[model samples]
Target: MSPARVGRVIRRCVALLLVLGLAGCGDAAAAQTGTVTVFAAASLTESFTTLGRQFEEAHPGNRVVFNFGGSSALATQINEGAPADVFAAAAPANMATVTGAAAPVTFVRNQLVIAVTDGNPKRVTGLAGLTAPGLKVALCAESVPCGAAAATALAAAGVSLTPVTLEQDVKAALAKVRFGEVDAALVYRTDAEASAADVDGIEFPESAKAINDYPIVLLKDAANPGGGQMFIDYVLSADGVRVLTEAGFQAP
Candidate 1:
């Protein structure tokens, strides 16, 4: 081949190599992107949702998604092999069901409360007051972490009151108070505070027995492994603490 022809062939090979290099770089960038799914308790919905947004903004290349429900339900789902990277539970016992008390850490605390509709409906005062005759009350079912903690508090106080309805979750119980469907409902302080615009909280002495610590854990093989750690760290950070405190969670 002539010298000019040889030079032209060299230029064509150089352009092909450059195209392959750019394609490889694009593939690597795409592989690094993905969404992290978290299964958290219903009580954490507000704070976690806010925290999720903060996390997505901070980590630019990833997205954070949450599945919020009762602690028991969330734990059951995780244990059943749900595709989740993080689990933020409302109670240690519930966390134990999935994480088995090995790696979870308590990140915040909360206590039970007697929340009533606006105007202190029915003159409710304390735990003992819930047992009054003719007063409709709402409570979470025995299965949920909040319900279990509530049962412990009531038993400790020697108060036995039957709820008109056993809600599926704490928010549902609090909804009863917010809508005036029930005179009072036993719900977490955070739930009451979240619904403060619609209901009022009455702190009770017996609630001390019902205090709960929320635990968060990153799954062993998290799809978004580093994202889970970042989120957990953020929850323990200043911004996460602010959101949790504003939502009425006690400092851990």
Candidate 2:
């Protein structure tokens, strides 16, 4: 071993160590200041995405992201250890499945509406209208908020129908009407309103008994509490309720 050769080998080892250290630091920083992912109900897609943008703007240091699906599915993901900062569910029962009975503010309430094609080819007007024989109807699957509410509304009206299909979520249920695949679908009034340009929504009296409340919360695994809590607060604020109300959700 010559002294010059030994020095060159030592220099290369030092350079490699420095590169590895820098890479680790970059990875750690990325993990520390990451986007806050929210597992949310499908019905909240429009409103939550709208608020997600506001949250990012309000907290420039953090980014807000959403994973929207059925409330039950969202709960399953959270319970299954998905990295989530918050969970917003269409029903408290669904939220409780993952978050437990911890106090959660009811952010909004949604009523069932009959979503029909833009021209309403079937002229479906109310809950009773669904009783018409041979009329195809689309309702959210039993596991979804809108579907549960629809069932309640139907029970309240003493009317029943053989639905063409049960969709996975409110969004899919609404699509049946917009695509003209079914004559009508039961969905949250807000969902129908969100697609007003494409579908017609029929309000009915029985919806009162079937209103489902939406609850939002900051999850236990939140990476960005600053942005997460702020987003939850905003959804419960007057302005947020106004947006929900305008979109056909009731104030909780």
TM-scores, all models, native as reference: 0.84, 0.83
Give the winner by lDDT. 1
Per-residue lDDT tens digits of candidate 2, residues 1-252?
Answer: 999999999999999999999999987654444477888888888887887777666556667788999998888878888888788899988888885424677888888888888888888878888879889898887787778888898999999788989888999999888888888898888888999999988889999998898888887667666556777877777767776777777877
After superposing candidate 1 on the true structure, give the runs of residues whose Cα lies further than 4 Å from its correct spot. Answer: 1-33, 99-102
Cα deviation in Å at residue 97, candidate 1? 1.1
What CA RMSD would you report for each candidate? 6.9, 10.2
Number of the top TM-score candidate: 1
Q: How do the residues 65-115 of candidate 1 rate in per-residue lDDT, one tens digit apiece? A: 899899998888887878888889988888888843349989999998889
Candidate 1, residue 209: Cα displacement in angstroms equals 1.2
